[model samples]
Target chain A: MSNTQGNLNTTAEVGIVEDGGSFPPFDSTTYPSQLLWLVLSFGVFYWVMSKVVLPRIGGILEDRRDRIAGDMAEASRLKQETDEAIASYESALAEARKKATTMAHDARSKVKAETESARAAAEEQLAAKLSESEQSISKITAESLSHVGEIAAETTGELVKALIGGRAPAKAEVAKAVDAALK
Target chain B: MAGNSGNAIDPIHQFHISKIFPVEIGGVDFSFTNASLFMVVTVAVATLFLVLSTNRRGLVPSRAQLMAEMSYEFVAATLRGSAGNDGMRFFPLVFSLFMFVFVANMLGMFPYFFTVTSQIIVTFALAILVIGTVTIYGFFKHGAGFLKLFVPSGVPAGVIPLVSAIEVISFLSRPVSLSVRLFANMLAGHITLKVFAGFVVMLTGFGAVGVASAVLPLILTVAITALEFLVAFLQAYVFTVLTCMYLADALHPSH
Candidate 1:
């Protein structure tokens, strides 16, 4: 449609020459193309960014992520180890406490058992002493009684004999008296 | 063959870059020309786009803001996907470059518009700048350590020098290679379009039979024009991406 309008101007009539001059010299006849320069400049800058700057920045970011991940993992591992250590410590402490209480209970029971055995031994010693004292008392009492009997009998006989000498007729009376006393 | 139009100026002469500066210094020809003017215009337009897009302050961007956002996003995404998050920072440069070249290319599709990029000097200059920046950046960041980039880690020491020398040569050749790729593609596409267009005009200008024959050329022109549009955009995109890759090399100094 635009071509039908005959918009091909003076420049359009000219054809591209392969062997065109080395470069355009500054002149009205040969003007620089704005679009070309724009494209060229853009191309250059883009090339620099894509080629040089972008990759390094990427590397740095990648490095940062890696570092952060590594640090976090290390910290987590360390924390886990610490938690295990604490749990083990508490368990050990609880075990020790349990053992201590068991030991205390056993000691108290031993003390109570020793006290009961000591009390039984003391009771047996007391019973033996009481029996021996009773035996001695009985023996002493028997000896005293026998001595008194002997003394009394001898005195009576002597009296009787004196009375009989004074009077031969009294012999029957003395024998009767002895018999009554015996009865 | 349509009889030669006796008054027709040599069509090829139109492409000449007539000297504006009749002077030379140290064997270097520095001259202002149409190609230079277009370069200035491209830069000005690019700057204008950036300034206009960002000038207004808004929590929610308006149409212009959206346009600006999309442009940056498109370029940034492409760079990031190709390069990485690190490339995101270089969004402005890549985006601008793509826009400038793309706009220039589209503009040239217009009948009268000049294609400055069609010139080797313009393309070469741009390529040189990229290469130079990459080299400079590598040395600045890595110091002498940048040399190690060519030494591929894990390689045997016996072959180190040989490998490094090869790497250096290839690296040094980047600018020329880059310049030629863009220049060659643009030059070829434009020339083909022009020749086809010429055929359409000349053939149809003859009798009815000529016009019927001209239909084939016209159809071809239409197809070429559409294809050219794609080519224009593609070339720009390819050029920009390649530049980014080269810069990546410099930043990391990879062998």
Candidate 2:
């Protein structure tokens, strides 16, 4: 390879006699080609980057950003909905608690009122029975006293008949005697 | 042939251009050469890497896609940082320049491969392209107001001419510095690596002691090669960064 390179350099030296063994970079003969190719190649590169490569990457990045934003929005919306649901559920629980308390209070008061009325009715019936019994006892006592008086009068008349033979007392006199004894 | 020759440790020999297919057009030698071949290879490799990586366009990006995206965002961020969002208009140009230079530099790191960016004309051409874009776009966008780039806003009236002159000179030197920085770095790094490698080769010509002593230069060569790799990436970055700054000047010329 070195020998070939040597040969090539000899040939290049012979072909380009004007180069005069100057530094390759400073050699102006190669500038036109280098510049030409640079322009052409760089031009093509610029075109590809601008027209094809950049847009594709840009589009991908934009799409990813949009998707992330959309996902975040959805998550936030769902969270809001969940918060609303929780709020409504709490309110409903509070309402139910209030209603149950009211119902229990009403039932307690109604039971108390029914018990009071029943107790009052029973007391009134007992009082009426006591008064009726008192009235019957008083009547029976009066009747028994009248019978005792009659018996007393009969006994007095028998004794008189026995003592004074054949002397009968008058009915009016007997009634008067009996009435005085009773008095 | 130069490698076989005992004392022929000519580092410049690697840079020599040879015609692969000689052709004449209008009496000018437009022959395809090794430099041209490498340029085409750089373009092909860069294109393939970019295109194939994004072929799937997966929302969940693959590794190659991630790499492609990183490169895009990296360049994009640099431009946006210096030139603002408006500089994105020149994204294609900037991206192309970066990829071409970076890939060309990386490919040249291979043994026996031709380095396209080592040529001054090529780097000069790219620098001119950047400066040309800046000048043309500056004038087109800002008209004569673009000249305000030379006139800083808060300068005293006394030194306005001096400041403007300095600004003009600096602006003019942008291309020269841009091109030379990259070209010199590559040239010097390669030459240094070649010279150190030549030391290792030359030392091995001695007996057992020479082979043992070659270890030092060999180690240095390895270290220099690593440094060259870093420089390869760095030069590309520096070139693109300057390009972005210049474009920024074009975008907003008033200091």
DockQ of each: 0.06, 0.33
Superposed by TM-score, candidate 2 places the C-alpha of residue A4 at a distance from the truth, in angstroms, of 11
- Residue-wise lDDT of candidate 2 within B168-248, one digit each (tens)? 999999989999999999888888988999998889999899999999999999999999999999999999999999999
The Cα local distance difference test for each model comes to 0.63, 0.88
Candidate 2 residue-wise lDDT at A179: 89
| A59-140: candidate 2 lDDT, tens digit per residue | 9999999999999999999999999999999999999999999999999999999999999899999999988999998889
TM-score of each: 0.55, 0.82
The ten-residue window of minimal lDDT in model 2 chain B covers B1-10
Cα lDDT of model 1 by residue, A14-84, tens digit: 31333332333222233234233345555554554455433433344456568789999999999999999
Considering the true interface contacts (CA pairs under 8 Å between chains A and B), give the fraction that model 2 also has: 0.51
Indicate which candidate wins on TM-score. 2
Model 2 lDDT, residue B13, Cα: 58
The number of the candidate with the highest DockQ is 2
Question: By summed lDDT, which 10 consecutive residues of candidate 1 chain B come out lowest?
Answer: B1-10
For model 2 the TM-score comes to 0.82
